[model samples]
Target chain A: MTFNRRNFLGVAIAGTAALSAPRVLGQAKPHVVIVGGGAGGATAARYIAKDSDGAIDVTLIEPTRKYYTCFFSNLYIGGFRDFASIGHTYGGLASDYGVNVVHDWVIGVDRDAMTVTTAAGHSFGYDRLIVAPGIDFVEGSVPGWSTAAQNKMPHSWKAGSQTQLLKAQIEAMPEGGTYCMVAPPNPFRCPPGPYERVSMVAHVLKASNPTAKILIVDPKEKFSKQALFEEGWNKHYAGMIERVGPDFGGANVSVNPDAMEVDIDGTVEKVDVCNVIPAQKAGHIAHAMGLTNDSGFCPIDPATMQSQVDENIHVLGDATIAGDMPKSGFSANSQAKVAAMAVRGALTDSRVFPAKYSNTCWSLIDTEDGIKVGASYQATDEKIAKVDGFISQTGEDAALRKATFEESLGWYAGITADMFG
Target chain B: MRERVFFALALALGGAGEGAADGHAEAIGDAERGAEIWVYCSGCHQIGPDAEIGIGPPLTGIFGRRAASVEGFPYSKSMSRMGSDGLTWTLTTLDAYIENPLVLVSGTRMSFEGLEDPTERADLLAFLREYSDKPSNIPEAAPTARPDYPKLSEETLALVGDEAYGEYLSSECTTCHQRDGSDQGIPSITLWPEKDFVVAMHAYKQKLRPHPVMQMMASRLSDEEIAALAAYFGSLSN
Candidate 1:
């Protein structure tokens, strides 16, 4: 047979017809319903739809039309990134990848029925369900502080307007005033996040109020990349930041939002600004679906990210007790790819690859002073465990730090594109 | 007659012989496989039209070209000196260099540990060849002088795999590999080919691979243990 342009065009037209035959025949395609269109859900929805070549129906349920990444919201607070840079829409997921992006809250899940009922009264049936609800703050973790008092003492952990509110509060602080941060207990989203936030807060305060003192009340003695953060705090914002550990009345803390007073073991301290990052658990939907354990996070099979509670459902990102992996956006995005692959294989009988995962958390300290901690991970029978890891050493030269910071900017762009598209 | 003429031209161009070319024709180290291997190189190097300089120079038209020739790219002193000393990229040279960059030029700034698997290197070379100006002239065969890996026998496959045992052994593997299938700078190892898994572990164990941590980890595993891991990871659906 002679292969000419006419012949190729004929074959191409025939191929297009063959590809569209299923839809033309009105055959129902397998549906993948993803809840919580954050890094995990959005990525899974995109990958499944893109890779399946329209054979799988993908639906993404997110309450918000636009997503504000908690990853670099601290940069927004520190004035490194604008609020617009952190915000992303699902238009690309909808238009580019053919995902049915539904802007509605997932109210409940019927696992036996393999369906999800949204707050808008829409029900989505799925061959596979991915839950990536991210995190929700534990109510009243700090005494006299709740969601109602968030306006007074902005948690600002979830990004969005609260981040803007906190930024405004920090910028409005009086000269030589105090900015107190009540850090959360262990196993929270972004382990180094609170520290990076403190660094960003200091970065902002140093330029505006050089005499402004920042205080940290922490429950844990050591945090992620403690030495690096402490060194940065001392080097860049020395005499401006004070961290109070449990030994020094860091723990045993309570707050009064009405009076704007923080009591550290009955020691009342009135501050100009209070950034309370309350203790957190998996988002409410996880609890409602009975996916979480006593630790308030979902347990999963490391090999496939299938929930230990139910094999039909998978959990990703900050919501899962992810072995050695931290609850960061990077971790969540990584898990989403694996989950997507597994879901595709389960639904479409595609080739499945072994699960390999990696995550790196970059923290910016002042301008061009960036540090990172990262590791590669593989799935063992027990859990996702860390392999080797690396962190930027203290006292590194400015040039190297600048390069590291630049690398992080590239990563932010790359990861955001990976998630949204 | 066409195959004979192609082989004759390939031989005249100092490419691979018929035996090696025929092996590649069977798809052992085809361009498609090479593209998969190229993901490792993509971190530093780029190829194809419109490829720009990254951490490493763009590798478009690299075949038979002088090393460090791309303008505006900052080459290490050693690389510049090597280029001046008559270093040129060819299938053979690339095969050697990619296997161990430091060995080829001791002070070169390219920090890639190098492709330890000869098949993977051949695959990458095949992919890179396509981006060159004279792709047809480039070799399509695996290099003659290459490291030999221990073959996994049918007996080994039948005897070694115990999913439970493999899972028990994989705790160390998961340390660096996120079970959630995320790729940081590190590549994910989920659902890897069982044969590829065994070969790679054996390479690391025998000190043929360059990563210090992998070498240490591989050194501790026995053949059965490695096979068991291969089985466990191969069974994954992610």
Candidate 2:
């Protein structure tokens, strides 16, 4: 649809709008640059570009040549699905949405000049900038956790090399070898994610090496779907999965990477394989550019997704402090659409409408069994809070579990379509 | 005669589509448009046909069924507790309930600010009537008997700090409570009969509410703030 002159001018007069029609159309469509093409930024680019058509020039700068999702990475570890199934290409974005996909890491953003500088030394000027650069692992939190040691002890938090490395470690372990996992603190990437990862890994251990044991050194006593997880663990895995919470001597205070051992409650235990998902914060570039606050996350208006720090910049997905919503692909996808709508509203110079976001997390316990927790969020004056929510009741209904599996796949497809296609 | 027949045929061609009689005219409802209307109800009830029930039981078949007829959906202890509460839901009863359920049946679980506009209420009632089972003839039950509860004495009111200041502080509670009293899982605070509302607020302040989220919220407010919150919620129509 062609931009109507009257509607464009009316929106511009609103002053809060992101793109003034004359200014947007007068020169070039105001460049809306997005950093990171994983879930959030890529989706934003696809949506804003498509909605604006030729009215907004959208550029997506992501370091990765190809994108691999963390959603079904657990299935790969369990040997249920291959790595190929979860991996995706940005071709759909470039070809279908006409998004300018640039394979480069953004180093910094000059808020004053509104230019984003990349590691490759290319500076793209933008009328509006969106950053959704996921999370960075805090290596030094566990005494021995570092990049060098990550090869032997993988975090597998970001899903590509780390996932493969951890899977290989699990395969190489002897029949009776120990598989230890360290779950991070709350407000991390995904709340129920670590538990799901552990559950999936345990499934592999039970199938290949029944005698092998899985240990979780957890920081929190209560976990998401604790009752359902315990029931499944007992019924399916049986003697395979063993958990150690804060009550037990399982609190991982430190680790010795070289020795391949973790120190818990002054006890040093050596393990055959270790998957440490460490504490995380907004990606480093946002920090370097002074976009993050003391909380290590950027604060933004839930309605507009525009940073409170700098109005010119909008942060979506895992990078921003979106309240009550966890960092998941689904959450990111939902937030991206809201942010894109806001950007569109701003460009046209109109009042941006309020947004409601929905997040659903599905955890696969067995080949066919899965559990889900979901909530729909609304933007309040101060924060985003749950307007409606649900947890899977305790049961082993095959129909529900199967439906959840199919819905999870559909969710991924729909979200991907909303972003790139 | 030929020209007149041709003219009649031309007029018929232009406007004849409206005159065709159909038996299933009412059965074929506008589900697409109905989906948009579903937004108004979604605050309390999940509109999904298969969606698991939330706070106010599922409305999958509220259309033509008797009011509060969903089995397994635990009716309010107030309604069930009232004993022999013969409230058969009809279009008129539903319209009245939408305007103000508390006014219609004082102790009912529904605490919604009834739809004020007559036409809108009728449309919503028609929408509900479209899905209900058999229409039944029954008179709306008399008002629920109010349980005896103690009111705040003058001394207690004195203890609650300044009254004027409390009224000013009640604005924040509206973040969750819209004027129409739509909510999911959360009780519509507006419809609370004053005494129960006051007691509940005091209980929350005293750390009686099971939830830490509510307890934390309650602990922060002062005695004056509590009174103001109570007054604001009491003023709201559920």
Candidate 3:
């Protein structure tokens, strides 16, 4: 039978009554359908399933069975970790946490009927839905660069093949060649990502191709950890890296992956490799569901991570306009906990706690040298406001830097375990 | 005990000092909420003017007291040792010990599992502060001087890790320090009492030990998270 509105309302009403009744054997459990099993969705699915202990059914839909986290993909390029180490399978979430892991791309969301349609012709009904489809690049944000040209000028922003391809291209660059990066504008995932990638590439080239030059054509006037990155570049890779900010016409940039040329305003320069990170918007599913606003991202209630557009729908991670929080995996994981608690409280008679968020982004500049920026946040009426923060200083001792790097490794292990289990 | 309580209230002298002006004097906690939480402690101890010790010593004024300062009290040997070792109860020490008594003093006989909720701890401390030595006339005086605790740990937040025991083990030194060791300078303290070791860790966790690495390692640990580490290392010699 078709999952039309009339049929949905009938089942939804019955499901609502079932939720209020004492849960026992043979009772219909409230189902929570989640789209995009990245940091946010996977963590939420795990939390709800594990915490509820079978009171709520969790279905996580994604296109990939082996999820590659974007957070540590840059480190994979830097050779700090193997590609497989960053790629995690949903076996644990499935076997251990009892999450129904569905490997399918979500095609559409019937908001009126409260159902999600998948590309495989399956429809999932939900008592609540969490949309955590990370981000999608705007069609024409970067002139002369598109997903079709992605192979030639790999935008390894998303992990997996693109990441491997970008790493390979950087390694294969001719000795003394140039590596050019067109950084994205504000409100992008992982604010320090592009710079960290540049560092990783330079770390590779500095060893293999010593005289290779790295150029950053950044649209923003300043970037995250600008001071720390600059100091590290000057000290470690002196005269090896150059960045052109908006003042130097960095904003007006175009790339030709075929010709291997980058035009900055009017001047054109031939480069060996170009990594184009274009402006991004909420995933197509969010837009398709009419959840995103004019900013191309979904605005959420700071207290619950619930989409302001729809009460039954929640948004997480890079797709959200999280106030005062950078779009990082840590942020997404933090937001996921809040959304999970809210979802459980609404569906079941669970205890609802006040919302708290915290995030830390660790960027490695060179071997054994890592810098971190982090802040703890509290949900206020306006938004998630920053309470306290700490950043690694420019002149930190070598021992401290090594310790910070070690701490980051611990965090990666902790978060992935938190997500998958 | 009176000295420590007075010291915390000392910061409140001059009624509204520069500390309060600069917003350093935030409320210690809500005593009303704290009173509700005191039920967990009331089984072993008592507070207020007519209070008396039951299973544990009377905690009428515990803040400034040494580990085993109460007169005629048959405190645990470890706590008595800690008292002699100069383990005074300031606000920081009180907060840490109340969060997890076993973590602060491994041999303490107080069988109450700690208050893991930091807000509840703060509120309980607020209620206990009522029974602490305070001048009732100074209405706006700082309740109890909490020397700059991290706001995140208090703002009704919690991070629940599954391998809490494993993470607790990470903060402990026995993973590196040996059951048998006395190399050049490292002593063969495998025979050392668990109470001494727990007291040393309390110093490190409280930033009293003042080493960078140890502080970082201990700061993130929750109450029950460290129980396994203490149980494993505390009895190593046995």
Candidate 4:
């Protein structure tokens, strides 16, 4: 019960025999325990398992039977794609790569012991633990948007259930009904995501209920893909979508769901349906385990994703305070691979390579065309720096639009394959 | 009907058991192991025993299939353009693309983290061969966050909510080039559109925007952590 440092390798090594485990696990192999089955966790599992070649033991702890990716959730809402398109399973990690998959939410972490305690009350010790469980909403950031209230005014930031609820509200609203969206200030997951959501929703509204309108209460004046998104909105939706930036009383200060109203600055406005994406921190487990500081996120050694306070534990994905980078699925997957490699190197006392990661995001402007942005990165002696990247340019080139849309699909296939495949 | 017949003839000549033997080197993927790998592919790809269109183009017979050749699927114009330009999907080409899709085809629509293991790629290719003769089946799983790990943690988080800290952060960033977006070597984070800055940073943190250094910087902030930093710097007059 008292997870000690010595127990780290022992615990990781013990869980190696669940499924498609390789026949030869070298004695010198390192041990890794990964928490979260999303992009980061799954990628780490695959690379570490494949690269280590049976030398490392990987145990992944995740609660969901299936994961619904937030990347293309906007597309689903836009009716460009369906929900099933972005959903994934962990069978590949279990069967192909020989990872031990546990279906349980992590409840706590015993950092000193290098052990992770799950909600099932089972504790798994690891020589190196990588945590990439994504973000958790910060309660009271918006006055009335509690976890309970979130059900009423779904944040849907986590995808799945919330996505359905938001969709349902949009569907049920009358032709002229008003839909209010509370956009988080900044540094949240998927920076361009909410705008994309609105774009998709507006597309749907225009067709199904022509007079329906969207009111975005943004704390900031601009957003990702601004010109391109505006171009699409103006050209397509016309007058259906209106955005209120900080300059226009969009910096909302409070929410009163009982009245179905959100107060921006000091003004309160009632709406028919509300979608409030509250401010967030690292997931509950990271916070509860003390991996996080007052800011409600974890701090780790950037090069290794190893917790600064606890080196044996690696905090990754949206949970860590990596500067400049956004919290996204692609970044999480890249980090997972790096962390897995680092864990393997550390366990076996092999040389750990310096890290490099890449990301690309495609925003669907319409059913036919899409916009994109991406960059590559490397670690220097002092910090992480971008090497190369690009964003889809403004204006519609039929070839570029079609190319972007197709590239989006390829990217979805490629990443999901990398993670789960 | 004509397409199906041609496909059948191609499968016969390609040799389903041994793979395409017309000097177009096929990958040496383990079909058995590849079958297991297919589970992950099913999440986003249309991969069953046979060819069936799913979230992505069916990978029923990808080994010898032309690049982006699924029928009825809206091919990215970049891809169709490539096809129009006479680009074909040979085994080697497929291998290169699988290693890194973006790099292999810059304008291609399939943005994926490439398969790192050589053997696994070969095996998956072999397994895909089995579907060449059967109906195509690919499962559609939604995509998740892309992977990116941070390269620094303590220093960056300490800079959160502090504009004065930009001097310190800029010290680390300036080594590559000037701080303004006008820098020549690396694109400048300074002077970027506020939304672009926030979203780009978010992408870096989530590992969707992959790089060693950016992942490192992005990994160190919380929501308030990022917002505070974004606000602090975004408010600065470039």
Candidate 5:
């Protein structure tokens, strides 16, 4: 317990390390640059800024000023929510949390120099970087469909105007017109999204055009919450929606956007409206930064969300191949906090706590009918391992289902508040 | 009779008259209004004729009953300690618990967020009273609820939470319960009395709370972790 000669030598070496820290040297506070100011990046920025209390410089760079969440965009199509309700801004992060909100696209990153270059030509030097650029469609993943043809057959997978366009097309269809969807393959954002979208589309048509039909062409053999979705479909929209799985050649499909037609395997069918959600990859910025792998998703250390490729860089949200956690806003928001805590502890000597992650996905089938699946996870040596979970059961009483639906609304408010503020 | 003595004691401590038993439970609050608020309690407490121990000890006879007296109910260790110390429930005690549960028994596992509004607490208590043995000679309503053994065991409540650690642990909770105390469909958990917060969370951790999401979130928290979260969130203002 005494500070003897050996302890004195150890103290001298530790003192050198402490002096090198920017906070100790009275230099500019350690700067943290975050990209893709959506759920992950925004929450990371907010946490770091709020926790550090001016001890760290947090700069959040994103191209969009108004971020629209993809999680609830389907509810908008079904008319359960207004378009404006899903959109959030970074003003809160700037004013309340003291984050530097830069509304510009990132052009490049010089990792060795620890600097980020944006299209505006501004350069930001950082002690730590967090990338959470979400997802981008794989070019030509669906034959005859690309961003060029997006105006004709909208993807609506990324939300924003594409979602509005898809909803408009579905509404404008003739009385007996067909609405077709080419769903994405395995490991897409929002696992229950495509089926839920179909449910919402059918909900609108059941009121406006009862004779209208909805068709789904999914490449996956099965999906998250398949039984629940199927039960709800039969109970609410029976005879109105149809799905063709990989067994039925759903994977072997293409579309002609101009002609408004879908080619399922060898059969060509005419449809009034088509929505093609293509194969996905980590957002382009992740690729540009050389962080993603052949899996088309960046791999990260499950414990800290640190990039496997770059020690100084951390990746979050849908862009990262988070083991066991699905690509959802809740997952992104959860990952961001761990990254922020690690970042703060690294730069500011803040207390580093054990990493915990959890996710819950809620989907609405029809009026007053909602379902959810959730799990709590702990970081194991291999991955973010699931510890416990629960899902809404089939044939649950109407009141319970209604409560779950209302809970989703509260979660929306809660998560967005967690993100934006 | 033991029952007679406790009832008279309850009336004396509560400071109300027997006129409350005829559904005019004004000593606590309107029993009628409490029925509407019963939706909040029914998930755990299942009172009235079919009362049964579920997530919590049934409130079948919560009023004037000793703490944790329901046999076969899985009471928390600390709650069992309080019950063993001769802590009995009266209208005043029920009001204090419903208003802020852990104030009287810090480690007890009744997970309900204490009803903040006094009238609401009174109504909820009156609703709970409907199942208890009828009032005797006087209305049992005044603010005299006191635990026979008031102080918590030093060993059980000794862990002083690290605020920084609590801040990090609270990230999981903030996903569904807002930090700013905004209650949409989920109740706001911010700015609770630290002891009350610990009890509410332990309720979930012990599988006494009903919501799946909250139960899952709470199940994995160690005791110190829950204490830390309680400390940090407790420091916030509503």
Candidate 6:
């Protein structure tokens, strides 16, 4: 079938009834209901259905028809990839994999009843459940800034419209204007994501508004790939990007989105554009499901990605407190596969391999300049521990960096196929 | 534990004859363990047919082949010179080279810190021997390859696949692959642009991709069935 955005949306809308009708009749097949069809949920849904060969019924509950990946959304902001390329739909998941793709918000999950209640007033029973709702920002973490002021100070962290808004704001910055960013606290989605955003914002500002200054008010003393990002910023966008860490009052920051002003410690500075990424927790659904612990993220068995709270329910993606692995799209995708394998083993009695996970997060510092950090992981009794790892050393040659960048493109292609297909 | 003790006995027996005789028997490694060790090599090098040139050269048929001998691969000057100096990749040479490539030939470009464990090196050698097309003489104690998937023959390629029939078989595939030839994580199999669809399918069938579900699915299909699916998907254009 020819799949495009319009036709896909049409199919999703048309097929919703047919998809849900069968399950409501109480089919004998073991049903796997997945929430939030992003990296983790989509992958788990596809894998379970595809591997089971129609033996298991799979239903993916995602509110949005089109998912904009947070992985390369930074590149979209940097003008490397267009906005459309990052957006994906559930057409393939429904049509190709025999998955029931329901476009609805899951309001509640009753673990005891083994049912998920959607906002559309429908309840779907599942033998197994996967919750991969990604992340939700902590309200009031950035004083005076809330979801209402998102337009004035966008946090393109979730992708979609916010990403577009942030891109436009960067492009619309006045010459020599300051673009201040309030970086999130620790244990946020994509440790290097905020820094990568800074690089992307700098890339746009450098080309369009050369004199524009980019200031990052970061809560942490150091971040993922700190040295590499710093080196890139110094070499490429010299004097344009400046990062203030906690020791320098970066932690004591408040943004008045209404006034377009930022207060760092006691000093107040008015900015042209404010990108505030507040502290984050597991997507609200996990909390609602009572899956989250004190850390505000769900804990899972490293071997299976099954929630500690509920063995029948597996939690994946940025929502899970995966040890040693950073909260990145690559990590989520890797975790999903492990969970899928475990699910398949439990349901279909398939041969289960030892849980081996790997992730490589590639960041484009500038055009053709890419850096990466990756490690192979093995699940022990306690957590997923890193085996051996590699990182792009500072002062890598342009050719190698370009090759690394190109490698990331292949990964993006490969991983997306792995998830969506 | 039994295997380790046997390995230790083999090493003890060979200690006196180390320099006088070829240590092929001493280096007889367990191919099963080698498969595990090969995971480290997989990050850069690939083995088996249809394996593309990646960060490192494909290691298929590497046994007995000269160092830096693979056509189209750009070997470092040091490696090329070593090959030119008649450095063949026999079990002994392979063992030494894999243990310490830089030490074996100074200035070689292979950046892996050498496999320090002797048993691991031996096992990797045993695994490589099983895959090499024109394998060198195997030692008596060398382990055999895992009997998972059969190697493809010329007849398998000659078998014609019905594209129309393949279209019926492709619903499972198109779920992840975009009609426009875009890819997500599964890779764009449309147009057969990257590789021969049959060869790629065979790779999955042989569990070369190491994805268990893909292996299981591929294992269930006949050669003709795979060909038909490949024919349909391969005929697609971007």
Cα lDDT, model 4, residue A235: 85
**Candidate 1: CAPRI quality band:** incorrect
* Local lDDT at B230 for model 1: 86
Tens digit of per-residue lDDT, candidate 4, span B1-91: 3444344334433454444333222334445566665555655576444657766788766654656667788776546655532345544
Report the CA-based lDDT of candidate 4 relative to the real structure.
Answer: 0.67
Between candidates 4 and 6, the one scoring higher on lDDT is: 6
Candidate 5's C-alpha runs over 4 A off are: A1-27, B1-154
| Candidate 3: fraction of native contacts reproduced | 0.00
Instruction: Using TM-score, give the best candidate's number.
Output: 5
Give per-residue CA lDDT, model 5, range A1-421, as digits (tens): 1113344334333443444222233234677899998889999999999989999889999999899899999999999999999999999999999999999999998776567888988877677889999999999899999999998989998879998998899989999999999999867888989988998999999999999988899899988888999999999988999899999989999898888889999899999999899999999999999999999999998889999898779999999999999999999999999999888877766777789999999999999898999998878878888899998888876756776788899999999999998
List per-candidate RMSD values in Å. Answer: 15.8, 17.9, 14.4, 19.9, 10.9, 14.1
TM-scores of the models, in the given order?
0.66, 0.62, 0.67, 0.63, 0.77, 0.66
Off by over 4 Å in 2: A1-26, A349-351, B1-238
Minimum summed lDDT over a 10-residue window in model 2 chain B is located at B141-150
Scored against the native two-chain complex, candidate 3 gets a DockQ of 0.03
The global C-alpha lDDT for each of the candidates, from Candidate 1 onward, is 0.77, 0.66, 0.74, 0.67, 0.81, 0.76
Q: What's the DockQ for every one of the candidates?
A: 0.03, 0.02, 0.03, 0.02, 0.33, 0.04
Residues A1-421, candidate 2: write the lDDT tens digits.
1235455434333432343222233343567899988778887887787767678889999989878888888878888779987788788888888888999988777675566778887877676789998999776866778767888888998989889989999989997999988888776887888878878888888878889988888888788888888888887888888788888865556777778888888888889998888888898887877889988888988777788887777898888899999888778877887787777776754334447576778888887787878776778879878775667767745655664565455455555545556
What tens digits encode model 6's per-residue C-alpha lDDT throughout A1-421?
Answer: 0114344334333433345432444344667899999888988888788878898889999999899999899999999999999999989989999999999999987665577889999888776789999999999899989999999999988999999999998888888999999999989998889888899988998888999999999989889998999999999999998888999999999988778999999899999999999999999999999999999999999999999998878999899989888888877877887788777777665656567666678899999898888766778878888875667789876755775686578677766777887
What TM-score results for chain B in every one of the models?
A: 0.50, 0.40, 0.55, 0.44, 0.52, 0.47
For residues B37-134, write the lDDT of model 3, one tens digit per residue: 66677667766556666788887767666668788889975576456435676666677677667555655788876777767877776566555564
Clashes of each: 21, 19, 2, 102, 6, 10
Off by over 4 Å in 6: A1-26, B1-238
Please tell me how candidate 5 rates in CAPRI terms.
Answer: acceptable
